[model samples]
Target: MKFSLIFLLLALTSCSKKEAESERTAHSEPAWDASFFSPKTGEILSYRETIESISPQKNLPISPDQIRKRVLKRRQVYDGSELIEGKTLHRYSIYHDGSFTEGFLFHWVNGFLYVVGSFTEDQKITFANPPIPIAHLNMIAGTYWHWPPQAPAGSGSRHIGLEQITVPAGTFDAYKVSIRKNTQGKITLREYWFAPKIGIVKEQNRIYSSGHLRVINTIELSDRSTSDTSDTSEEAPSEST
Candidate 1:
């Protein structure tokens, strides 16, 4: 009887120790580094974009003739930084064919990269409520997170896995992440390939309407330059109307 009692005590102690270790592991901070996406102040990244309208319909805003097989050049410049809601966010000015299109503000916080806000044509800043989470710095395959915090199931971003991709710029072992959003009857899926210290190497956006595929737009890194010289070239022809 004494031996059985002692055995029971040993078993209980082992279980308690395991439970404590599991709790600690669950609450521990994840390993991540925001520098993986930190770009220099003067960094300039150029990309080649291909926009295709797979199944163009009359109701579609873009006509069938607007679909272009040719690739267009786009540029993004890390021009400045700002302090928003106590967070330091970097501003990226997006240009298409030398014309200013828009700007995005990004920042890292609590092991996550977020799109804190965006800039308008007049350089006005509009912040996102609760800031949209872009990627988890320490994400691994099967890791998942969602924006708006209370979004429904399956409406979120997931780390697909690591993939070796080749673009016009070069080949890189990038982490593939997928973000899905469903609104009304429309569904949009955006996939991003990020290379360490190089930011987004490729992006593909697929939009569907009423359960049918409609458009697929892809942007791949074609060239990157960190030259401090100011851009003064004339605007190139626009790729899309």
Candidate 2:
């Protein structure tokens, strides 16, 4: 009887210890960033944060206007894709105002360089020359984008960089992120996390290309600025014309 009682106590203690360890692990994991995806559509978005000039080692203060200046641009040189052989090159620049300039496409196509047929500014939100959906566009902001965020209770950015963020049904992690210009030309590929943060903490497939792994990206934004009009716009009711 004593032996059985002692064994029971040991088993209970071991289970308790294991449970405590798991809790600690979970609690210690860092929170995701704020600007990783398009809030509207939940699509992956990437952008570079360019400063007017480097201020040595100090963290430079970035104003909203400063953030708006740096836009999304892409350059591609094809060595051998099904679309082009040898070397076909393309350079794209997307303006914050939803305007774009494509030297090659404009030089040859004669039509507007929008990937989608043609669109007005407001209509372009969905037609986003890049073809990003409205919902995805909502998640993505002009801020040199970051990661998916945790709720208020889980507030704060995770600096360690999540190799992979996984929930019961989703997962997100990246392998690498770089801009390469080979004989084929310039190509920027961002290896993304398998399952990134979603509406609720969930697991997902790597829908976007991230060089086959979760790419490490610098985090920005602790709490979104309340004074920003963008935040207010998110709260405003949508009106259809």
Candidate 3:
């Protein structure tokens, strides 16, 4: 649901030592462009998504409709670039189906994206100041980063090299970021793929409860459009976290 893109908006900011490792390791790797995730103002990107749910009750019968894929098309456009609290941020307007935001604000800090905050439909700031990294920026095939730099040990992400992942948009050389962990009897795994200049084109998630499959969700980029970047310009309002 909303978590698909919301998680994509949040991911990596490491401490100095880890950052030094990223710099050294990424120095020889293929250069990653910031435009892979951030487009110029007035730019728009579209995607067709399909979500499926599963029922793991082996003894019970499940209807065919319970496993049907729900397909949808979403459009997001970069409104402008703004400077908030001395940090440069990019502003975007996300359209669900064809409607405007229903209390969502996404921003990027130093190229890394964050949820930042959100508002009610009437513009009332219901929740205003949540800083979390769902994804890192300009990462190569060997970089490592985390959402909160102060997170507990062993909970972070690793760049698992680059590969050519195919989707509805076509074949793209994308960087794969993996997050994996097992707690008690539950296993949680997530993978994200980003193509240069096209953005996060695909994502997959799996949850295994007590060694049995609970659910699986996958999203792919079915279609997209990118306009010329050099001519984009717009002034944005000042807002800070």
Alpha-carbon runs more than 4 Å astray in model 1: 1-34, 54-70, 229-241
TM-score for each model: 0.74, 0.20, 0.60
lDDT of 1: 0.75
Residue lDDT tens for model 1, 106-217: 8766777788888987868888787877766676999887777877678888899878888877777788999898888789999998776777889999999855677788
Tens-place lDDT digits, model 2, residues 1-241: 9899999999999998787555433322121233332122212122232222222233335333432223232211111111111111122232322333222211111211112322232323122233211112122222122222222222221222234443222233421122121222212222222112222121121211222222223221111112223232121112210
- Candidate 3 CA-lDDT value: 0.59
Pairing residues by index, what is the TM-score of model 2? 0.20
RMSD in Å for all candidates: 16.4, 24.8, 15.2
Clashes found in each candidate (C-alpha, N, C closer than 3 A)? 0, 40, 6
- 2 or 3, greater by lDDT: 3
Error of 1 at 27 (Å): 31
lDDT on C-alpha atoms for all candidate structures: 0.75, 0.25, 0.59
Best by TM-score: 1
- The collision pairs in model 3 are 10-133, 10-134, 10-135, 11-133, 11-134, 11-135
Q: Give me the displacement of residue 208 in model 2, in angstroms.
A: 21
| Ordered list by lDDT, greatest first | 1, 3, 2
